[model samples]
Target: MRELERYYRVLELEPGASLDEVNQAYKDLAFVWHPDRMPQDNQRLKDKAVSKLQQINEARDKLRSHKARLHVPSTRAASQSASNPTSQQTTTSKTTSRQAYSSQSRTPQEPSYQPPKPHPDLTGKDYSGANLTNRDFSGRNMSYANLKGANLSDTFMHKVNLFGADLSEANLFRANLLLADLREANLQSANLIGADLSGADLRGADLRGARVMIGDRVQVKLIGALLNGAIMPDGSIHE
Candidate 1:
């Protein structure tokens, strides 16, 4: 039981979480700790990420196996019931009666479908390699969008929702990203020189190999930003 609890903690999940919750947590952690999102030159951080990923995978696998084992007895009982001719006859009779009752109570109705209206939510959009410099995207919901290798130099993205977005190798030079929701964003090797990230929520964001500093000084502004669990530009995990 202690071992199982440890697995749940590794995945940031509560004990006794359902299988669906386990799968979701696994996917979220895997994406955050993926080697491709880490700096290739930082061997120490890369190794750490690998180890973390291994732990996450093991936790997910063990929990899945445990859940499967728990359902084995129910499965066996279901198979046994299916093999019993009398049980199958009784189940068929009940199912047929229910179906007949449902059909009798059913009434035909006209379709009331309406076409979906367009919205500004840009979740999961692919804008790779696009030149979007000097654009204003304030307060926009662009979560999980693919902006890899895009040129966003000098863009205004204040309060934009970039959660889980892939900005790897993108050019964000001098961009205004104040108060942006950038949690879990992959910013590996992205150019953040002269960018204003003050008040941004960067929790769990991967900034490995990102250019946020010049010489011994950080060129980008990170004042008032939330950096908990975020990998810094130099591949150091923020405490």
Candidate 2:
């Protein structure tokens, strides 16, 4: 019981908090204590953040496991109650009627996917290893930001300023970077698979070992963009 309470306290939640609340608290705390949010020069703070994140993750996992174990007993009781011959017949009848009614009713269609609204200017922010998939960050000034190892899959960053940003090892899978300013950005070993870089300025950017091609065919667009002094995927320096 004391251990359980400790986990809840780690997540900043009260005892007996609902699973939804626990999950939400975990997400919020993870974002707050993520190492990328701290200054790279500050090793002390960054180490603390890393330690906090690990604790948060552990707390969340333990709480979830406890919740699952608690749920199993209730489910077993429900099953035992339903196993009685009289109760089984009644349940079957009710289930058949409900299924018939549901068949007659029109099924609701799932909502279409909507792009995320624009956020305030995120210039120079640290979002390393963050899951920002399918978001629209078009025209945002994120210059010199630390986005190393961030998940930017399917993100629309058209015309965004990422000048000199540390994007090494970041996942840019299918991201839209049309006309964006990526001058001198560190993209070493980054995943640029299926990314749209049409007309984007990547002058002097480090692309060594970055995946910009698939099987000898260039999969990314560099139409009319500057690559002066940038390193190519093959470890060759671009002229």
Candidate 3:
């Protein structure tokens, strides 16, 4: 059965497309959906770009592998031919039986490999106290997400929209949160050791009692971030 239709659809081509066609189609779509072309502030477009690029890559690979496999000789057919040279000259009555055997030995129909489903949509979702260590949540819209007491250590959250999200008591050790919009976020008692918050928007964010220091030295990075009305790691607040 032809299970390659999905690949063709991804490439915007009809079934029975040549291998060359698939390669060209992937290039065309990737160029159009690439995230670099989108505006820096457009988080929605960037997320879409990441998901689209992944699908295009998978489609091209599946089609190319299938084509390559078709060219390889069947080991079972070759072995049968070598073992039954005398039987190859079968009578007319036995010719039908050989044809049936050859058909049975044909290459099996293998399903194409599809990548696992993408991460769940976290838009305004409640995930308080979730252990989400080392996860990649870059370029996502997690506005108002309830992340209180969540372990987000080493997570990638670049350019994410976490406006009004509750990140109280979250562990963000060594996390990459560059250029994230954390306006009005609650970071009370969160462990931000070695976390990068460069170019982030911390306007009105509450960071009181946050673990942002290591032996009197600040372990958090906040270069180019907006801190209007934000509470500092200490008891004082930023005017």
Candidate 4:
């Protein structure tokens, strides 16, 4: 498995290295294997790297604890550390101390860390009334999809494919939709106030009753879009 090979490469010792050597090797290998330093798109590789790091940590723990010193000590140590009451107590105490120190040394945890979901490949699929506010759907293929009444406020959809999509009554307030393909899309009554539509294709698209402004000055200036029946920024209705 890739996991086994990664662990072996990280330790740099033969397949039967002592736990002490593995720990020392981990200290050296961590510099290059740290997940934060790795490329973002290589998440699976970084996860494997982290798993190997954990194995090194387990190897060191087994050696120090004087438990069974098998060739693959990490696997056995983890099981023992989990099942043994003394080891569990020691682990709990250390964790509690670390937590107390961390509380003082670090800032409080942020409320929640729900990462933005990746855009679904829903090209030509009907997604009417979908609540996708403040989501990043940039540069995705969503052409010919029915997105009527969708809440897409403040969404980042730059250079996305939206040709012939039904975006009628959709909330696109302050959205960054620059260079997007929206030809023949039904944008009638769509709330596009403050949305950036620079270089976007809107030929034959319905702009009837669409709100295209925010305040006295246009928050999002439409560079090359239709203005038929759309509300202008200066409160003057576009004919």
Best by TM-score: 3
| Prediction 2 TM-score vs. true | 0.50
**What overall lDDT, based on C-alpha atoms, would model 1 receive against the true structure?**
0.83
lDDT per residue for candidate 3 within 100-189, as digits (tens), equals 666666655633345448766687898888989867688889999999999998777888899999999999998878789999999999
List the candidates' TM-scores in order.
0.51, 0.50, 0.55, 0.45
- The superposed Cα distance between candidate 2 and the true structure at residue 117, in angstroms, equals 11
Tell me the lDDT of model 3 at 24.
70
Q: 1-239, model 1: which lDDT tens digit per residue?
A: 99999999999999999998998787667656855445657898889999999999999999988876665322343344345445446766866655655454443442223434655789999999999986667678999999999999977787899999999999999887878999999999999998878789999999999987788888887877899999987788999
Query: Which clashing pairs does model 3 show?
Result: none
lDDT of 2 at 96: 69
Best by lDDT: 1
lDDT of 3: 0.82
Regions more than 4 Å wrong, model 3: 1-109, 113-120
Total clashes, candidate 2? 0
Instruction: Please give the distance, in angstroms, between residue 224's alpha carbon in candidate 3 and its true position after superposition.
Output: 1.0
Model 1, poorest ten-residue lDDT window?
106-115
